[model samples]
Every structure is written in structure tokens, then in C-alpha cells.
Target: MTITIVGVGLLGGSFALAVREKYPKATFVGVDASPVHGQLALAKGIVDQMKPLDEAVAVSTLVVLATPVNTILDLLPRVLDHLPEGATVTDLGSTKGLICQLADAHPKRAQFVAVHPMAGTENSGPGAAFRELLPGKNLIICDREKSRPDSLKLVEALFSDIGMKLFYMNPQEHDLHLAYVSHLSHISSFALGLTVLEKEKDEQAIFDMASTGFSSTVRLAKSSPQMWAPIFDQNRTNVSQALGDYIEFLKQFKVLIDEQNLKDSSEFMARANQIRRVLEGIDRK
Candidate 1:
């Protein structure tokens, strides 16, 4: 099989590397809107060749879109329009409802498989990619019934080869859970970075006193603003609702601290501590 990967940044580049590791016999081609990225991906051996978008689509057996959320939405229909007959196209976008809707009645609709691999680091660019990122990760395959069985099975096999655990969910549910677990976390990280940077006013003080916890929480702040701004904007309703709920929780905790309601605060913390156990379970899987 020949796989052409579009937008060779963190996600796309990493995916290319993953495919190379798991499907070494398969031909690989990388395409990116950024000429530099295409060159870098080639230089770094992420793909066998870098080709123009349309030509790549024409020849590829599978085409993966790993562009930013907004760009992915715009690119999907164009890719669908150009894809070879029976070619499979999949996306690695975080949010999915809009993309699913856009591809709903596409002529190659059966070839479209909507996927979000629940994996990433607070990094971007071809250089940031590594093959280990996808393994053992939970991948949500949204609305699989829309895809042809062969196309869906092919996608599933690819993810399985990379050691991914598959889960199925409708796009609407995926977006809602993602808003709380993924989108809201990024917002919290960005806001926390701004809050600390604004108050500290001294870079050295932040550098000297910051703990690992602080570093971990704010790491997502380093992510590309261009990629993330549109994601937050596109999923504004869901993200905003999650953010409001997060703020309310914070406010309640603040009030508890102010009132010296130590017992109540302890109970709240005990409940939240279940997250560590849940994460432990995931790791065990």
C-alpha cells in the first residue's frame, strides 16, 4: 500500500514514522502546505518521497490528513474530490462533528474514516515527531458505519499495528468528552501560563521557583497558537461550556479555602484524586 500523509507537523510526521515502523513494505509520501516541512520530512526520512497534494492523492491507497482543525475541515472536501476510486482518507483532527457532517454526502463518503488518536505532546513540527507517540494510546473511531467495511477495517488494522486500543463513539459524544478532557485542559494550561506570567513580572523568579507540577500543567502553552486558536474557535460552544464549568469549580474551591472549610475541601480533593487511579487503570491496559 502507498500512504500519503498531508501536513507533516507533529501529528502528521509522527504518523509517517509510525507507518514506516509498522508497515515498512508500504510506500510512503509526505505532503505539507509548508515547503520547509516537506523538505524537513524528506530529510528526516519520514517519507519515501514528498509530492504535490493532488498528485499524491491520485496515487495513494490511503491518505491521512493531520492538518490543524480548521485547515482539515477545508481540506477534506478537496481531498475527497481528488481521491482515487476506493482510496481511503482519514483525519487526525481533535474535534469531529463538523468534519463528519462535511463528508457526510461526499461521493467518496464510504472511503472517509474519522479518527482521533488520543495521543500527543505539547510540541509541534516534523522534528518533534517520534514513532512511540501512538502506541498504547486510545483511538476514537467516530461513526464507523459511514465508512465502507474494508476501509474501516484497513484503518483499524493500521491503528492496531501501532499498538493502539480502539474505541467507537458518535462524533457528538466524542466532541463533548474531548471538550472536557482535552480542550478544557489546554485552555487551563494557557490561562495558567498567562496568569503566572502576568503576576510574576519577573521571568527569573518564575524560572527559579517553578515546580514540576507547574511545568507539567503549563507545558501545553508551548503548542502552536495558530493551530489551537482555530480549534477553540471552531468548538467554541462546547469549549466555552467546559471552561465555564471549570471556572465555577475553581470558584467553589476558592470559597471553601477562604471559609476554612477544611473538611469539605479534603473531601473534594479525595474525589478528584480518583483521576490518578483512573489514569493508572489506563496505563495498565
Candidate 2:
């Protein structure tokens, strides 16, 4: 089988590596805008060859779109324009609603399967990819019924082969839930990083005084802005709502602290601690 991985960044490169383990004979082609990323992908054995998007996708049995959400928006139609009959197309884009809506209008809609693998790190590029990233991760498959059974089955089996657990949801649910769970976390991290950087003019002081908790909390701030900016834009409504809700809670907490109400502040912290229980239960699952 010939598989084309568009973008060849972290998710795309990692998918190529993991899927190769499952289908050793499968040949991989990479399509990337960056000359450096294309060269790195080839050098790292992430792909057997690198080709322009149109040429590589024209002959592919499967094409995985792992570019930013905005790029995916522009490329999906063109990808469908070049897709071979009966071939499958799937994406690892974080936002699903608009992508799915766009796919729905295409004549080759049934050939596309919309997916978001709930995995990644605050890193970009093919060099940051590792085969282990997808294993044991949760993958959300949206609008499953809209896809051809064969196309859907092919994607499902491939993700399963790579050791990912699958879940199903509509495009609306996928975007809304992810806005709160994934997007909000990154936004909070970025805010925390900016807050500290603004207040602590002394970089050395920050480095010395930073705790592991602060480091972990701020790590997502280092994520690629090129990738995340489009995600926040694509899912703006949901993300905006999530942020508004979050800001309200911050306001409430500030009120408690400003009044020096130790009792209220302590209760707020105690309530916040429940997240630990929630996360622990999820880990147990």
C-alpha cells in the first residue's frame, strides 16, 4: 500500500512510523511545505520518499492530513479533487467540526474519515516525532456514519493496529469537548507563562525560583503558535465560551482573596482539589 502523509510534522511522522510497524511492506510518501521538514522526514526514515502534495496524493491508497487546521480547511477539497476512487482519506487535525462540514459538501465525501487523535506534545516538526506517541492514546472518530464502511474500517483497523483506543462523537461534541479539555489547557498555560514573564523581569530569578509544578503548567506555552493559532481560530466559538467560563471562576476566586476571606478561599481550594479525583479516576480507566 502507498500511504501519503501530508505535513509530516509530529503527528504525521509518528503515524508513519507506528503504522509501518503494523504494515511493514507499506511504502510511505511525505508532503511538506518546509524543505527542512521534507529532508528530515526522508533522512529519519519517516517516509521512503517526499513528493509534492498533488503528485503524492494522486496515487495514494490512504492520505493522512496532519497539517494545521487552517491548512486542512484549504487542502481537503483539493485532496478530494485528486483522490483515487475507493482510496481513503483521514485527518489528524485537532478541530473536527469545520473539516467534517467541508467534507460533507464534496462529491467524494464518503471517502473521507474525520479523526482527531488525542495525543501530542509541545513540539513540532518531523524530528520531534517518535513511534511511541500514538500507542495507548485515545482517538476520536467523528461523523463515522458519513464515511464509506470500507474507508471507515480501514482507518479504524490502522489506528487499532497502532494501539490506540477509539471513541465516537459528532463534530459538534468533538469540538466543544476539546475546546474545554485540550484548547483551554493550552490557553491557560500560555497565560500563566506570559503572566510570569511580565512580572518577573529577572529571567534568572524565574529560572531559579520555578517549581516543577510551574514548569509543568507552563510547558504548553512553548507549543507551536503556527499550529495552535489556527486551532483556536477554527474553534473560536467553543473556545471563547470556555475562556469566558474560566475567567468568571478566576474573578470569583479573586473576590474571595481580595476580601481576605480565608474561609471562602480555603473552600475554593478544597473544591478545586476534586479535579485530582476526577483525573485519578480517568487514569484508573
Best by TM-score: 2
Model 2, stretches more than 4 Å misplaced? 282-285
Judge candidate 1 against the unseen true structure and give its global Cα lDDT, from 0 to 1: 0.91
lDDT by residue (tens digit), candidate 2, 1-285: 999999999999999999999999999999999999999999999999999999998889999999999999999999999999989999999999999999999999999999999899999999999999999889999999999999999999999999999999999999999999999999999999999999999999999998999999999999999999999999999999999999999999999999999999999999999899879976764
Tens digit per residue, CA lDDT, model 1, 201-252 = 9999999999999998999987788888988887788999999999999999
- Point to the candidate with the largest lDDT: 2
Candidate 2's TM-score reads 0.98
Cα lDDT, all candidates: 0.91, 0.96
List ranges where model 1 is wrong by over 4 Å: none
TM-score of model 1 vs. true structure: 0.97
Please give the distance, in angstroms, between residue 240's alpha carbon in candidate 1 and its true position after superposition. 1.3
